[model samples]
Target: MEFVITGDGSNTLYHPEIGEHYHSKHGALQESRHVFLDMGLHHFLAKEETNEVSVLEVGFGTGLNFLLTADDATRRSLQLHYCGIEAYPLPTDVIFATGYHRFVQPATWAAFMQNYAQALTTEVDFAEHIRLKIAHEKLMDFQTDDQFDVLYFDAFAAIHQPEMWSDQSLAHICSYLKPGGIFVTYAITGNLKRSMKALGFTVEKAPGAPGKREMLRATKVG
Candidate 1:
C-alpha cells in the first residue's frame, strides 16, 4: 500500500495488489462525506425520531468513515454504535501516515486515534455518545444478530472484488438492516440496483461525489 494525496487534500491508500485506491482519486474526505455521511447516516437520522443510530461499514480501510461518523455523532449528541468490518486491516504506521488528522479538528484527533488503536483489539467507547467496534473479518464470513439503521457499503469496485457485490452477498448484508434502514454506496451499477430491489430495498440514484457521475441509495422496505 502507498500513500497518495487525493484531490481534496486528503490522503488515501493505493493497493498495488489490486490496483485500486481505497477511495476516489478525486478526493477521499469529500467522497466519504458526500456518499456515506450525508447520504447514509444523516439521511436516515433526519426521518427517524431516535437519538441513537447504528452504522455498519463494509470496508474500514483507513478509518475515514469511522472518524467522520464519530465527529458527526459528537456534534449532534447522538448515540452512535459503529461496527466496521475489514478483511485486510491496515498497519498502524499506514494509518498514521495517511495524516487523517488534517481533515479533523485538532482537539478530537488525539482521542480519535487513541480510540482507533484500542478498537483494533476490542470494542471501545470513544466518547459519551460514540461506541466503535472493528471486526477483522471478511463481509461474506461475518455474522451478527444486531440490526443496524444505516450501512456504509464502501467496498472496492465490483470489478476488483466481484464477490463482495454478488447478489447473495448483498442479500446477506441486507438481512442485517432494520426495516426502513438505509444502504448507501459509491458504485451505481445496474446489477447492483437490481440486486437491491430483488432483496426488497427501495433503491434510488443519488448525485455522486466530485469524481463520480452517480451513486446509489437504498432503503429496506420490509
Candidate 2:
C-alpha cells in the first residue's frame, strides 16, 4: 500500500493488489466523516437518547473511522464500544505514518496508538469514554455475542473485492446488528440495496461524499 494525497489534501493508501484506494480519492477524511461518522454514528445518536453506543466496522483499513468516532465520543462524553474487522491489518508504522492523528484529539490519537496492537488481542479501554477492539479476521469468520447499534461497511468496492459485497457476506455481517441497528456505507448500488432489503433492512440512499453521487444508510428491521 502506498500513500496518496487525496483531492481534499488528506492522505489515503492505494492498495496496488486490490486496485483500489482505502478511501475515496475525492477526500479520505471527508469520506470517513460523511459516511461513517456523521451518517452512521451521528444519525444513530440523534435517533436515540443514549449515553452509550456500540459500533462495528468492516474494513478498518487505516483506523480513520475509529479515530474520528473516538473524538466525537470524547466531545459528547459518551461511552463508545467500537469493534472493527480487518482481514489484513496494516503495519504499526504505516498507521502512524498516515498523519491521521492530526485529524483527531491529541489524547484520542495517543490512546489509540498506544492500544492499537493490544486491541487486536482483546478489547482495550481506548479512553475514559471509548472501548476498542479489532478482530483480525475475515468477515465470514468473525463472531461476536455483542450486537451493535451501528455498522460501518467500509470494505473495498465490489469491483475490487466482489466476495466482500456478496449477499451471503451481507447476511453474515448484518446478523451482528441489533433489531434497530443502523448500517451505513460509502456505496450504493442496485444489488446492494436489493441485498439489504432482502435481509430486512429499511435502506435509503443518502448524499455521497465529494466523488460519488450517493451512499446508503439502512436500518435493521428484522
Candidate 3:
C-alpha cells in the first residue's frame, strides 16, 4: 500500500498501509460519509436553499466530500459553488489507491474523479450550475472575498493537526460566513467549542456517528 491505514482493516475502508490518516476503526471514508455527508450535509441542505449553496471546506483531503456533494447537487438538480482549501494534496495514484471506486460506480466514479482531477489544475465550471475553485495552499494563507452559506471544517483531528483547529484560524473562517450560516465538523473539543462561541457562533452538540462521542454544528448568528 502507498499510504498506511490505521485501525482494523475490516472496519477501515482504505488500506492501512496506504492511507495517511484514520478517523475511527471504520476508516476515513466511513467517518466522512457518516459524520459530514450523511449527518452534516444532509442536515444543512434540508433547512437551506440548494438552488445555489456556497460551500467552504477546509482540509479538502481526498476530495471525497466534494465528490459526494457534487453528486448530491447533480441529483438534486441544484446549483453548487464549491470552494476548498488544502495544504498538502495527495497524488491521484494515492487517491485511487484508496479504492474509492469500490463505493462509487465505475462510470460514475470515473466522471466524478475526472472532475476532481480537473479541479486541481484549473478553476472551471464542471456543469452549468456547478463550479469548483480550489486553492492549492495552506488554510492559514487562504483569504476569500466571498461569503458561504455552509462551511465544512474537515481538518485533521485536533491531536494530529492542532494548528488547523486553532481559534484564530476558525475566527478567520467565520469572517466570510453569511448570517445564520452553518459550520460543521467532527470535532467537539471543549476548547474548540469555547473558541467558536467566542467567535460569535451558537454552538450545538449533535449525535456523532459510531465510535465518536459528539460532533459540532454551529451557526453564525447575527
User: Best by lDDT, which number?
Assistant: 2
lDDT of 2 by residue, 53-75 (tens): 99999998899999999899999
Best by TM-score: 2
For each predicted model, how many residue pairs clash, with residues at least 3 apart or on different chains?
Answer: 0, 0, 8
| Alpha-carbon local distance difference test for all models | 0.89, 0.94, 0.74
Candidate 3 lDDT over residue span 1-222, tens digit each: 334453434122332433335345545566777677766667777887557788888877667777777777777877888888876676776666665566654554676566766777667686677888777788778877799888888876776667878887888877888888888888798998899999988999987766787889998989
| Model 2, residue 179: C-alpha shift (Å) | 1.0
lDDT of 1 at 33: 98
Choose 1 or 3, whichever is better by TM-score. 1
The whole-model C-alpha lDDT of candidate 3 against the native structure comes to 0.74
Summarize candidate 1's per-residue lDDT along 11-80 as a digit string, tens digits: 8999998899999999999999999999999899889998899999999999999888888887888999
TM-score of each: 0.97, 0.98, 0.85
lDDT of 1 at 204: 94
* Residue 116 lDDT, candidate 3, scale 0-100: 68
Span of 10 residues, lowest total lDDT, candidate 3:
6-15
Please give the range of 10 consecutive residues that has the lowest summed lDDT in model 1.
104-113
